[model samples]
Each structure stands twice: as C-alpha cells, then as structure tokens.
Target: MSVTRHKVWDPLVRIFHWSLVIAFAANALFTDPESNLHEWIGYVVVALIAIRILWGVVGTRYARFTSFPPSASGALGQLSDIATGRKRAHLGHTPLGAMMIYNLLLTMLAIGVSGYMMTTNAYWGVDWVEELHEIFVTWAEISIVLHIGAVIWESLRTGVNLPRAMVSGVKTVPEGIKIEP
Candidate 1:
C-alpha cells in the first residue's frame, strides 16, 4: 500500500502542543501547588492558551477553529467507525479530538483563573474557588489521558503514526483508507 504525506500541524501548533504538554505535566505531576514555581508554570500555561487562542483565529488551515467545528453527528460517526472497525484517516483533528482540544483549553483557563483568584485577598481561603481549581485540574488530567489513548488507538486502527505526526507536523496516510477532511 502506498502512503501519502499531508501537512496538518504547523510549527507553531506543534510547539504549542508539546510546550503545553510539558508545562501541564510539570504542574500536575511534579510541582507543589504552594510553590511560586507552580504559579509561574500556571502563568505559562495561561499565556500558551492565549497564544493558541489567537492562532486558532488566523493560523494555518488545520489550526483554525473553522477547520474543525465541533459536531455531535461527526463525533457519533467517528464512534461508529471505531465500533464497526472501519478505517478512516482524518487529515486534521477528528470531531471528538477537536472537542477534547476545546475542553482542555477551557479547563486550563478555568484552572488558571481559579488558581490566581486563590492568591488574591478577595478570594483568599475561598473554599469554592480552591475546590473549583482542583476540580478543573482533575478534569483536565482525565481529558489528557483520554486524548493520548485516542491518539494511540486511532494511529493503530488507521495505520497512522499520530504521535509522530504531531511531532513532525505531517500525517502519513495509508493507501485505500478513506480520508476525512
């Protein structure tokens, strides 16, 4: 079977993805919430999200939000493909993947905002804000795990090295596989 290369992720998008991954992983797994370093990392994450938000507006084709508007029907179709063992390659983000990306971005913002509020005099010791921050973090963590698993599963199912594609900014699609744009 022949394989074709498609340029999907731009350099900025790839950098944002991996940078956010490292920053989020550091804050979630290794840093103490009480430490200034943790706060700084949160700031970095917030800034990264902001940059990503801007990029989503005017970036390359696949990086723009319009390229992958969230669709319940599309997501359901993707699930159906998975259930039926159908091999389909998506040139950009899959319907569910786009939703997860949005979810993660918003969750990160929530975590950042709540975290900042906690340090302010107005919200100092505010139980709800702290709890909300923790809740957002937990949600983001869960979403991340699902995202990774889906990437791996999709890669194997479609004969695409999704992780490699993310790293290299290109997707290699096997011949005869139905492609979704």
Candidate 2:
C-alpha cells in the first residue's frame, strides 16, 4: 500500500521556525556583553515570537495550537510509549513534541520580554532584571537543544525527517494511516 502525503505545517510557520532558530542561535553566540547587536536580535526575536503566537491561533490546520496541544494526561501517555519503544506515527506533532513547542514559545517570550525590559528606563541598570533576563535566555538555550535532539531522535525512529517535512510542508504517512487532506 502506498502512503499518502499531506500538507501539515504551512510555509509561513516553517519559515518563521527556521528564521527564529537562526536569529536566536546567532543572538546566543555572536552577541557581545556590551554590544547593541544583542538588543537588536532580541527585538527581532520578540517580533517573530509575537507573530508566531498570533499565527498559532489563526494559522493553518496543522499549525494551529488547537490541532495538537498535548494535555497533561496525553503527555504522560506518551511517556509510556517512549519507554516501551512503541511510539505511534503522527502526521503532525506527537504529544510530547507539542508540549515542547509550547515550552519553546513561552520561554522565548519570557526571554524577549525580560530582555526588552532591561532596555527601558524603568528597568535599565536594574541588576535583578538583567539577572532574570539571563536566566530566561539560559532556559531558552536548554529548551532549544532539547527540542532539536527530540526532532532528530523522532526523525530517526519514525524514518521521517521532520526538518524536511517542515521545509516541504508535506509529510508521508504510514500506509495504514488516513490523512484527510
């Protein structure tokens, strides 16, 4: 039986994801302690993050948060599957993956908001806000590393390259799975 391919993530979402990845990675590595480049990168990240949140609510079917939010129970259920190595192939994000998506978004938002606050007069030179901003960035980095690792592992396990799927917006489903366009 031939597996059918369906459009999952939209082009805009894919572009946003990759672009944010590049920008965030660059911001993390290339920004100097006293340079303005980091601030500019933070601004771009903030805009991208805000746009993505809006898109989550009004984006394409597979891209919408409603389509794949993993409830607490759902996430726990996947833990068993992961333990048993009996993971089900999903046309979109799996339960754990969905949670990671939410985490990444929220963490990025926190980092961006805190970083922005440090530039404002009310918060400028406030040592505590700077410390909090640094903490947020650290979490964002850790979350991103975990997210990439999961993507790689899932791709290898399922024989489906997730990055490729995001780029193409088309994913090949298993023969027994039915994707409704």
Candidate 3:
C-alpha cells in the first residue's frame, strides 16, 4: 500500500498549537495560582488564542475557519463513521475535532476573563469569581484529556499520524482513504 503526504497544518497553526500546549501545561500544572508566572502564562494563552482566531480568518486553506466549521450534523456523521469503523482522513479538522477546537477556545477565553476578574478591584476576593476561574480551569483540564484520547483513537482508526501532522504540518494518508475537503 502506498501513502501520499499532504500539507495540512500551516506554520502559524502548528506553532500556536504547540505553544498553547506548553502555556496551558505550565499554568495548569507547574505554577502556583497566585504566582506572577501563572498570570503571565495566562496572558500568553490569551494572546495565542487571539492570534489563532485571526489566523482562522485569513490563514492557509486548512487553517481557515471556513475549512472546518462546527456542525452538529457533521459531528453526528463523524460519530456514525466511528461507530461503524469507517476510515476517513480529514485534511483540516474532522467535525468532532472542529467542535473540540471551538470548545477549548471558548473555555480558555472564559478562564482568562474569570482570572482577570479575580485581579480586579470590583471582583477581587469575591468567592464566585475565584470559583468560576477554578471551574474553567478544571473544564479545560478535562477537555485536554479527552482531546488527547480522541486524537489517539482517531489516528489509530484512520491510520493518520495526527500528532505528527501537527508537528510537521503534513499528514501522510494512506492511499484510497476518503479525505474530507
């Protein structure tokens, strides 16, 4: 069997993806919540997300939002594909993956906002603001776990090197696999 390689993730997208991983891990696991480093990492995450949002508008073919918009029906179809063991390679993001991207983006923004509120005079020392920040962090953690698992599962099912694709900006898809445009 022959495999063909295609450029999927652009340079900016790849950088943003890995940079977010590092920043999120640093803030979530390694830094104290009250430390300056944690706050700085949070700011970095906000900036990264902002850049990604802009990239999704004017970036490469695979990086654009038009390449993979969130859709319930499309997600359902991907779910159905998984249930039946159907193999397909998505050049951009699969439907479920697209949904997850949007989810993490929004969740990170919420975390940033809540964390900022905790630093403000009006919301400082407020119990609910702190609680909301914690909640968003926890949700992001759970979502990260699920995201990793899904990537591995889909990679195995479709025989696509998803993690490598993110690193190398290319996906080596097996010939005859149906690739989503």
Candidate 4:
C-alpha cells in the first residue's frame, strides 16, 4: 500500500492531547484526593480543557470543531462500517471519535467543577458532592479506556497509527483508502 502523510494534528492540539492525558492519569492514579498536589493538578486539567475548548473554535483546519462535528448518524454509520468489515479512515476525527472527544471534554468539565466544589466550604464535607465527583472521575476513567481501545482498533483496521499521529501531528494514512472528510 502506498503511504501519504497528512498533517492532521497541529502542535497545540497534540500538546493539549498529551497534556490532558498526563494530567488525567496523574490525578486518577497517582495523586491523593485530599492533597494539595491533587487539587493543583485538577486545576491544571481544567485549564488545559478550557484552552482546548477555545482552540477548537479558532485552531487549524483539522483542529477546529467544525472539522469533526459530532453527529449521531455519522457515528452509527461508522459502526456500520466496522460491522460490515469496511475500512474507512477519517482525515481528522471520525464521527465516533468526535463524539468521544465531546464526551471527554464535558466529562472533564464535570470532574473539574465537581472537584472545585469539593474545595469550597459549601461543598466541603458534603457526601453527595464527593460521591458526584467520584462518579465523574469513574466515568472519565472508563471513557479514557474506551478511547484508547477505539484508537488502537481504528488504527489497526485502517492501517493508521493513531497514537503516533497524536504525538507527531501527522497521520500517515495508506494511499487509496476511503477517507471520510
């Protein structure tokens, strides 16, 4: 198969992607819930996501939300393609991937807001708030796992190295593949 490299992810997008990954992972796995480090990291996570939301509005061609708007029918179509053993690649984010991006973005926002709430006198020592925060974190953890699995699955199915693309800002898609815009 012939190969063609597309500059799909810009540097800011890549940085935000990896930084979010690291910050989320640290908070989820390493940091103590009551520690100052955990709270600081939570703020960092919120800030990164805030910047990403702005970037999605005015970023590069493929980085903008317009490039990969979330669509339910499109996501269903992607699932149908998978079930039919059809290999279609997306030049940027696939519809399903876009949905996940939106999900994760909203989830992170929930986690951040809930986390922040826990810090306030109003919410401090409130059991429901703590439970809600934990629930959001759990959902984020599950979503992250699924995201990784989908990336690997799509990469293998479409002959694309998705993780590498995220890291290096390029998608070396195989030539002649059916690419969804």
Candidate 5:
C-alpha cells in the first residue's frame, strides 16, 4: 500500500525540539556544573522552553496546545488502544505524548528556575535549592528516557517515522493505518 504524508510539526517546533535535546544533554552530561558554560546552557534551555510555550499558543496547527490538550480520558484511551493491540497514528501528539510534553516542559522549567536561584545571593549556598535542582534534573532525565522509548514503540506500532517526522515536519502514514483526527 502507498503512504500518505502530511506536515505535522512546524519549523519552529522542530528546531525547539532538537535544540532542547542538545542543551539538556550538554548540561546534564557534559558541562561542568560550577562553570559559566553550564549556567549559559541552562539559560538557553529556559529560553527555548519559553519560545516553545509561545509557539504552542500562536504557532501552526500541530504546534498549538489546543491541538493536543492534556486529557485524562484521552490518555486512558491511548493506553487502551495499546493494550488491545490497536494501531492509531496521531496527526500531532498522541495523548500520552502530550502528557510527556507537559511533563518535560514543567520539569525543565523547574530545573531552570532552581538553577537560577542557586546563582542568586538569596539562594546561593542553600543546600535545599541545589538539591531541588538535582531532583528535577533526575526526573527530567527519567522522563526523557521514557519519551524516547515511547516514540520508538509508537513509531513501530503505527508504522510511522516519528523521529523523521520531527526532523522533516511531515509524517508518512501508511494507507491502512487508523489516524486519530
């Protein structure tokens, strides 16, 4: 069967997505925590998240928050589909994926805020603030791992190239795949 391709992620969204990946990885894995580079990368992450939030409000169809609003029922439905071995390709983010997006956004924001606070006189040398930042970073790391696994699982299940879609802004759905509207 033939494949039908549709543009889903926009250019800004794709850029933000990959930029966050690099920024987060650099700070979490490579950068020296006490150095200026780490602080700058943290700020970059904050800026990227801010841009993404704005784009979610005023960007293209797939980038808008309205396109994939957080819903308990929607998440449950997706879980059910998985349990029942049903394949459904979502035009934008699946409900579970939407939840992950919110999770990462909030988690990243928390990390950024805490990291900034550590640099302030009021919060500097505060053990709790530093610990809180570490906690958020750990959570974000766990969430990132889950996010990657879910993307791979969903891509194979629905026969969609999810990573490629994010990079190219288009998803090529197989003809017989059930696509969520």
Candidate 6:
C-alpha cells in the first residue's frame, strides 16, 4: 500500500461551499415575493458568488478551478464508471463533482443577476425579466437537487463520508491511491 498527503481544500473554499448552501436554502425559505428579505438575500448571493469566483482564480492549490474542473470527456468517463458500478475512491472532487461546482456557481450567478435586474426601475415590473428570474431560480433549484443526490450517491459508492470530508477537509482514501498535495 502507498500513501500520499494532499491538501484537499483550502479554508476559503470549504467555508464558501457550506455558507453558500446555507445562504441559498435560507434565501429560499425566508424570502417572499412581497418582502424586501428576498432582495436582500439575492444581494448576499451575489456577493458570495463574486467572492467565490475571485477565490477560484487566486486561491490555494485545491481551491483553484484549474485544480479539479475536469474536461467534458473526463466527466463522461466518471459517469460511465458510476453507471457500471466501477467507481473508485477519489481524494478530491470527482470529475462530475467538479463539473457540478461550476454548474452551481453559474446557476447562482444567473439567479443573482436576474434578481438584480428586477430591482432596477427599467427592469422592475418588466414581465420578461421577472419571468427570466423565475426560470433561473428553477434551474438553480434543480442543480441543488442534483448536487445533493450526487453527494449521497458518492458516499454510498465510495464508503467515504463526503459531508464529513467537506467539514474536516480530509478524506481517507483506501490503500494504493496517491493523493496530490
């Protein structure tokens, strides 16, 4: 057996991941069409997305987008593995998981931007913009569902507690796997 030590994730990435989840959920639960709370929550999401994007560029090794955002082919390969029940333990996010991170960021950004447009006088009460905002929200929700489902599936397949890995920032890969530092 061989062992390798790796920096799974940086503090900023871990904190942003969980905070974004909580903020998105809270925004959905607390925001109402008639209340300013919804708009405030949208602003918070915008801020979070902005910070995360910036960090993705300049963050630590494990936090940078280049570190894990896989190519389209890589994602397809991972999907094939999962479908065929040949999954392996990955120290960091799998190819599909990496793609989902991108998806979540883009979706959240779309929701925030569309929501912001609704607040502008030029766009406020504009039927199409409002409709677009609703569409983006729907897309974001769908992505969230898929993300959660993937996490659960990965946990079952790998026997590694993904949620705990995110919390503790360390994953104990089985013998013979090499981790990148």
Query: What C-alpha lDDT values do all the predictions have?
Result: 0.95, 0.82, 0.94, 0.93, 0.96, 0.78
Candidate structures ordered by lDDT, highest first: 5, 1, 3, 4, 2, 6
RMSD of each: 0.7, 2.2, 0.7, 0.8, 0.6, 2.4
TM-scores of the candidates in the order shown: 0.98, 0.91, 0.98, 0.98, 0.99, 0.89
Deviation from native of the Cα of residue 84 in model 1, angstroms: 1.1
Off by over 4 Å in 1: none
Which pairs of residues have clashing backbones in candidate 4? none
Query: In candidate 2, what residue range of length 10 has the lowest lDDT sum?
Result: 172-181
Shift of residue 41 alpha carbon in model 1, Å: 0.5
What tens digits encode model 4's per-residue C-alpha lDDT throughout 1-181? 7898888899999999999999999999998889999999999999999999999998898989998998999999999999999888898999999999999999999999999999999999999999999999999999999999999999999898999999888888888788777
lDDT of 5 by residue, 75-149 (tens): 999999999998899999999999999999999999999999999999999999999999999999999999999
The better-scoring model by lDDT among 1 and 2 is 1
Give each model's clash number: 0, 0, 0, 0, 0, 0
For model 6, the stretches where C-alpha displacement exceeds 4 angstroms are 1-6, 176-181
Where does the lowest 10-residue lDDT sum fall in candidate 4? Answer: 172-181
Q: Least lDDT summed over 10 consecutive residues: which range in candidate 1?
A: 96-105
> Which residue pairs of candidate 1 clash?
none
Name the TM-score of candidate 4: 0.98
**Candidate 2 has which clashing residue pairs, if any?**
none
